[model samples]
Target: LVIDEIKGRDLRETLIAFGEHLMGAYMSPALIGVYRTVVAEANRYPTLGRTFYENGPARATGRLAEVLEAAEARGEIDADDCFRAASHFVGMIRDNLHLQVVLGLRPPPDADEARIAVLSAVDVFLNGVASHR
Candidate 1:
């Protein structure tokens, strides 16, 4: 479902969809708890961190990087480093909402809120990634 959401009409639409799905997925308490536990035990259990990265954020970032690289190849984006751009794209959309949810500052946003948040992040990210001729 998440991966399907990422395939959109264009790069910007794809990013917006990706951000929306990501926000939806991360809103889960179980996922948030897993993140907290993984971070807390990372030092004592290195493999835990490695496992989390391999199964979670790294996978997402890698997938997005592939898309970004394709866009770059097509001359749609001027990305010097697609992997780094992927990371920034996900981080920009996810970090603040995830933090707010984890800290109990706010509940996971509803559908309308998610739309607004994802679109806003996509706008900012698109601006940053725009080719400066």
Candidate 2:
């Protein structure tokens, strides 16, 4: 389901889908709690960090990087640094909405808000990449 959410008919659609999915997942209470607790205890229990990386963001970011690399090969974007671009892409999605929720500065976005936010993030990222390329 998670992988499918990040797969689309095209790169643009995939970015949108991924952004939407990421926002929704990150905003979930269970996920947020896990992230908080993991970070807080990761130093004392180093394997917790390893587990989180393997099971969580690593999977998504690695997938995203692979997609970006394919897109670059296809001349779809100017991604000289596919991994960095992928990381930045996810950061763009998470920075505002996810951070707000984590900080308790704002509630999680509703479906409509999530849709709009994801759309905007995809557009901004695509535009930036287009120009950079």
Top model by TM-score, which number? 1
Off by over 4 Å in 1: 1-8, 129-133
What are the per-residue Cα lDDT tens digits for candidate 1 across 1-133? 3555565469988887788777877887789889889988999999999999898888989988988988898888998999999999889878688898888799888899888988988888878656779
In candidate 1, how many Å is residue 38 off? Answer: 1.1
Q: Scored by CA lDDT, what does every candidate get?
A: 0.84, 0.83
Candidate 2 lDDT tens digits, 3-44: 554654588988887777788789999998898889889999
> Who wins the lDDT comparison?
1
Give the range where candidate 2 is weakest over 10 consecutive residues by summed lDDT: 1-10
Error of 1 at 83 (Å): 0.3
